[model samples]
Structure formats: structure tokens, C-alpha cells
Target: MPLATSLAIFQSCKIIGVPKSTRCAILRDMAKVRKAERRPPLNKTHKLKRQDWAKKYLKTDFSKVLWTDEMRVSLDGPDGWARGWIGKGQGAPVRLRRQQDGGGVLVWAGIIKDELVGPFQVEDGVELNSQSYCQFLEDTFFKQWYRKKSASFQKNMIFMQDNAPTHASKYSTAWLARKGIKEEKLMTWPPCSPDLNPIENLWSIIKCEIYKEGKQYTSLNSVWEAVVANVGFKKLVETLDKRYDFPSRNHFSRVCLPALYDECRQGVLKDLANVKYFATTTDLWSSQTMEPNMSLTVHFIDADFNMETRCLQTSYFPEDHTGQNIAAGLRQAIAAWNLDEGKLICMTTDNARNVTLAAQLNGWMRLQCFGHRLHLAIGKLDMIYGCNY
Candidate 1:
């Protein structure tokens, strides 16, 4: 029984609670007993075995080996996020939401000696069936990587890939045989494994490099631009050059396994500044206000003053319908991106009080749209002349 229960019974016996002498006696007796249990320790052990299989496989010479894989490129926002704080008060810790915009992506790739062959964007709705995979091999990967090599290299080349259903299917195997690709040349991939492929590392490096630049894309055009700008053939070749000599048998355990684990840790510490930064013209559209939808565009100029339109964002007017409210929305968007107030050099918009006021607040030199200006100019000339011309 609990000491509190015993104390309660003792107190019930008396009108003014238990006597001091009785309370002291109960406390003294309780102090003599002990409670609580200890738990036993757990033991764990891990062992690794490096195989000689890769050396035996390479005994036939590396000229016979070709590596292949696929990579997915998103047409919308890439599946990633920026780490930041959120919530309020004690015990209300911030959470990291994995940012992803629902959009289609393409996947196709291959590898050769210290070289990456194809990151060909797959056509939309094309499933990764045996026929599609074979088409990529014959048309894209072969034309891009194999045909360019010496005839001797082609005769001896062996393609390697994972046991993806498409790669292992009977139709794909038959296609390879018809193309003079030997079965022995296909590297035997272990089940449930990704560590054996170095292309995995290449993909990670590309994503990390892309994110490091602070770039975001909501449309397919922007996504393609970002992907093209980041992963050129030259960079892929360079990556392969550095890591190709790594042991094949222990490829996953030795290189990819450790690299992948490290990438996870790096991801936790990565930030928005890691994404590539670009400037572009942005047009804002909204229907809920009196102020006509405002459109403002900003351009980024390098040190050489070579200008390119980059960052684009939309601003909507709220119920206030005043110039102040419109200006406030634009300011909030600018502040969210952490752009320098003084560096914003230009603004282009239709002639409107809210638009002009917003530009003035930001100290930007305003340029009226020439097309709109031309229309107004032509209208005034016709009115003054009083002619149908």
C-alpha cells in the first residue's frame, strides 16, 4: 500500500489530522524500505565480408563492361525542401516539411568507362517496360556512348545493370542477344541493392549542387532549364573519371553505402542558399480586388552587366483595394526571398497608382511597357489630329 493511503487512514482517526509524533514515526519507518529495478544492457555486433568476385569478373578486362541506370527529373518543383523553424511556445518544436510539388518527371540513363551516357528524359506516359528499355538502349544509350567508341570496343562491350524487372525480362534479354550483347557481359546485380551502382552517387552530387544554388521551379520550362544548367555531359564524365576505379564487388558496401549514409546527414544541415539563384520577370494575377492585377518584373545583371531575367513571383491584392495593400503584398514577397533592397534595379508594369507607389517604396527605376506606351501614343495622336488615319 502507498504511504499516502496509510497517512490518509491515520488522519481520519483524528479530528485535526495525525499527531506530529505519529507522522514522524510513519516517515521514519518508510525510509527503511527501497524500490525500483535496474535493466540489463544490450549487446550488438556487425561483420563485413569483402568478396574477390569483382577481381575475377574484371579479369576479362574492363573494355567489355558497360554500366546502365535511369534517373528521374521532375517537371514541377523537385522533391526537396528548405530547413527552417516553425510553431510557437515551449515544447512546440519546429518541423521540417519535405517540400514537393505534384508534377511529372523523366528518367533514363546509362554508364561506360569513367563516363555517363544517357540521362535522356523519358517521354510522358511511357512505362519502363522491356520494349521501352530496349529502345533506349538501341537508340539513345548506344548512339550516344557506344557508336562513338572504336569498333573493337563495341565488339567486346558488356552492359551492366540492376535486376529491375525490365532489365531482367525475357524480352529485354532477347533484344540484348540480337544486338550482339553477351549475357556474361551483363554484370550480375544482387537483390535489393543500390550500393553497387556509382551512378547513385552522381545523382546525389547533381541534386546537392542544384540545391546549393537556391533555385526553384514551378513549371516544366524552368525545371528543364535548371536540370540542363546543372548536369551537362562534361560534369557527368568528370564524376565518373574520379570514381570508376573503385572496387566493383564491394561497390555498394565500400563506396555507395557510406556515401548514401553521409548524404542523409548532409541533407539535415542543407539550406535554401544551396539552390542556384536566378532572376526572371514575374506577372501577378488576382481577381478579388479593384486594383487591376499587378505585374512586376526584375532582372539579374552579372558584374559585366550582362542581364538575364530570372526570379519570378506573383502578388495578389487583398480586400483593402488600396495602393498600400498592393504595395504591402509586393514588399512581403521581396522580404521572403531576402533580396537586397538596393539591388532591385528595375520594375516594369502598366500605369497604375498601386504599381507606381510600390516601385517608389522600393527605390526602383520604373520602365513603362513600350507596347502599352505605343498604344497610348497612337490613341493620343489620332484624337488630336481628328482623323480616321
Candidate 2:
């Protein structure tokens, strides 16, 4: 329970004590504060479905499988990040929120042969149904890309999709069969199990790239542009052919990954050169091994007036987390990216004293993240009332 709630309980029972002393007593009892992990609530049926699906695909080859999904990208952001700076006891920061979340674009995409496939965006207000989904398949994969593939490749290909009504509808199933994609070629995916989909991981990575540094779009077009630009599709087809075995773990980790990172780093640096002013966010984290790390992300509007965000650095910080040390680390990140300190507008971060002091030490204004503040407030309610919200 929160201290206030616990105190209220004790007061009801005619007990009183200092808040600090009460906290100390709780600590002596081996109680400690910890953050809760968020996860989807899965019932027994969902669990059994996942187990069956795992067993069915345990030894299945995924190289020839094409994974597809439809994702909606909002103008504001993926999670509609609400942020502001306000003093204690202030009401929630106000923003002119729009109806239906300012609209968004729904795009359908897939990955096959280790290459990204069609990313066809649906027309505004167009709800996807069986007929529309079949048309989407015909216009995208069947009419163009799939027809170009070799017959042998097509024979061995498998299509994977979630159990959405449009995906599993009788009309869509019949359409796939008519197009030579029979039952055996369709991968049976588990219900409510997106985490098992590799393409879902790709979507997560793409979204992170699109909305780096808390970047938000004012218009749907800008949001789509950001999505298309930062898709970061990997060029894996060349090395993933049947004649060639997959790259050895060491070769990929040590050589290919580093080369890819360097290429991407140069591109980001080139783009940042033209940016006049940008805001940054920083945070410290620790790995399972307790190795400390700090990250810096930059956000700015580009020449096209599209909000853009990119991670500048995530450096291992073995040094003490003093304000001066953190400031020095941030400076190193800024210097690494060839960023002008004068062009930095501010740093957004949680209400950590060291991080706050670090912003001050770097002569940067600090914007407290309202999301974190809201989380803390909600956490108090959870502790006091035993409410999960």
C-alpha cells in the first residue's frame, strides 16, 4: 500500500507515526519498491492455443514463410505520448485533443525471402473486410511480386497471418485457394499471440525508428512519410539463399552488424548536419548483469516540417552516476554526433535528481516527462487501494 493509504488505515485504528519512521519499519520487514511488468492477460484457452501452435510449428522451416500484418500509425504517435512540464498539485497538462485520435493510416506489409514486401496503405475510412483483404492480396502479392517469383519458390512458399476475421474469412480463404495458396501453404497462427510473430518484432523496431526521441507528426501524411523513410528494411536476401548457408553467428555479430551500424551512423550524422535546433532525451539503465548504461536520443523537425527522431548513442557508463559524470557522458554523445550544443533546445527526462542536475550542468533546460509523473501517481493509487490501474 502507499504510505498515505497505509497511514490512513493505521489512523483508523487509532495509530500514528512519522512517515519516515513508518517507511523505515517497512524496509526492516524486507519490503522494497519495484516496478511492475506489463503483459497482456491471457486466459487458459489462449495459453492452450499458444502451446498447440508452438508444437505444430516446432520444426517448421521459416525461410520460405511470408509473415504479414496490418499496423495503424497515428499522427500523434504510437502510444499518443502526452508530455508537459508542470509544478506539483497542478491538473493534467491540457492539449487540444482531436476526435478519433486525429485519424491515422493503416498499412499492410509483409516479409518474404528475407525481403520486405508490399506496404500498401489503406484509403482513409476504408475498413478492411474479407473482400477488401482478398483484393489487397491480389493487387499486391499475387498480381505483381508473387507472379515474378520462380515456380519452385512459389510451390514451397507459405503465407502466415493472424486470426483476424478478415484474414480467416471464408471468402478470403477461398480466394487464396483459387490463387493456388491452398490450406497446407497457409501457416496456422495462434490466437492473440503476436509476440510469436517475427514480423511483429520488425514492426516494433520500425516504430521505434519512426518515433525516436518522442517525435510526433502533426499530419497523417507526415506520419506516413516518417514510417516509409525509417522502415530500415534489411537486405538479407542476398545472403539467405538456398545455396548459401546462413552467416555464422560470429561473422554476423562482429562484422556485418558493425558495418551496418557504421553505415546507419553516417546517414544520421549527414542528416543532423542540416538540423538547426533539436530536443534530446536521456536515461540511465542497467542490464541484467548490473552493467550501467546511458542513452541519448535527438528529436527535431526536418526541412519538410516532419518531426524526426534518432538515437544518438547508448554508451556503457562504468563511472559513478553523478551529475557531472552524466553531463560529461551527454557531452560525449553530442560531440560524437557532431551536434552543436547551442542548437540543443532542451533535455526531457524523468524526475531523477542526478539527471536533472546533469541537464543543469550541461546548461540545458530540462522538461520533466509527464508520462513518468502520471505513472508515479498511478503507482501510489495501486499501493494504497490495491488497484492495478
Q: Return the number of clashes found in candidate 2.
A: 3
Off by over 4 Å in 2: 1-37, 80-96, 231-389
Error of 1 at 341 (Å): 58
- Most lDDT-accurate candidate: 2
Candidate 2: tens digits of C-alpha lDDT, residues 73-186: 886565545554668998764455666667889988888755777667787777899998888778777776889989998999998988899989889888888988877799
| C-alpha lDDT of residue 285 in model 2 | 97
Model 1, 244-345: lDDT tens digits are 433333675698778986775354223223223333233445654345454444465445556554333444544464566666766666666555555555
- Give the local distance difference test score of model 1: 0.59
- What are the RMSDs of all candidates, in order? 20.5, 19.7
**CA displacement after TM-score superposition, residue 328 of candidate 1 (Å):** 46
lDDT of each: 0.59, 0.80
